[model samples]
Target: MNEDLTFLVLRQLQANPKQTQLQLSQAIGISVGRTNYVVRALIERGLLKAEHFRNSKNKSAYAYLLTPEGIDTKARITARFIQRKRAEYDALRAELDQLTAEAEAEGLLPQ
Candidate 1:
């Protein structure tokens, strides 16, 4: 799975382990197949542990619990994501300020 999708799956799984693949697909805005594929990959990587829940309403239902490693990965991914967003926001803010100055210089914007 791609980095963006991997991060999202981890986040969604951490939020609710009981969420079905269909529910996760809808929440992540991806296809069920893709969601399954990603989850399988995570399981293979030892990040997520899928266990069947007999006491649950759905007999075939499973919970995707995060391992200790998975939690650490999530924290790292979250920090990186926040940093990337901050950089993007700073760049956009600077561009907007420049555009606003130009507009004001041209009298297109009220001073």
Candidate 2:
């Protein structure tokens, strides 16, 4: 999975371990198959632990818990994600400012 998707998956799983893959996919705007793949990848990477839900009616239900390493990874990913988003925001703000200036010069808006 990509960094953005990985970060989002980790964040969502951390927030609610009990969420199903469908719910996670919906929350992260990804397909269920992709979500399943990401979850499996995380488990294989030792970033997450999956435990069967004994009380759940569905035999396939599981609670995905983040391992200690997963928690650390999530923190690191969060920092990187924030930095990247801030850079994007800054660039968009500059672009918007330039557009506004051009619009004002063209008499498209009041000074």
Candidate 3:
């Protein structure tokens, strides 16, 4: 359960609460089972709420939406994720610079 993917899933649900797990799986490129698992986890965590809606296509199915708590959680998690990734990118760039400097000093690569 990637936090990024989880946030994206929540965002998607926010956009279209009526979208089915099957549809979400297709959109997210994940399996239906994984989507179901994540959705159930979100419900258990009080991050999502589902309601049964009667549409022309399906009468007995439900759709999902983020709870107020879910929206807050999504924002927090997404911000943290972005910060972490940016830090990682910066660290990797620093490491690359060090390696390049070492290589140039050793005459292993062109300056």
Model 2: lDDT of residue 96: 97
Candidate 1 lDDT over 1-111, as tens digits, reads 676788899999999999999999999999999899999999999899999997887777999999999999889988888898899999999999999999999999999
Q: How many backbone clashes does candidate 1 have?
A: 0
C-alpha TM-score for every candidate: 0.91, 0.96, 0.73
Pairs of residues clashing in candidate 2: none
Tens digits of per-residue lDDT for model 3 on 31-88?
9999999999999999999888866467757889799999999999889989999999
Which wins on lDDT, candidate 2 or candidate 3?
2
Specify the highest-TM-score model's number: 2
Top candidate on lDDT is 2
**Which segments of model 2 are wrong by more than 4 Å?**
none
Question: How many residue pairs clash in each candidate at the backbone level?
Answer: 0, 0, 0
Q: What is the C-alpha RMSD of each candidate to the true structure, in Å?
A: 1.3, 0.8, 2.8
Model 3 alpha-carbon drift over 4 Å, by segment = 96-111
Q: For residue 5, what is the lDDT in candidate 1? A: 80
lDDT of candidate model 1 versus the reference: 0.93
Candidate models: Cα lDDT each: 0.93, 0.96, 0.90
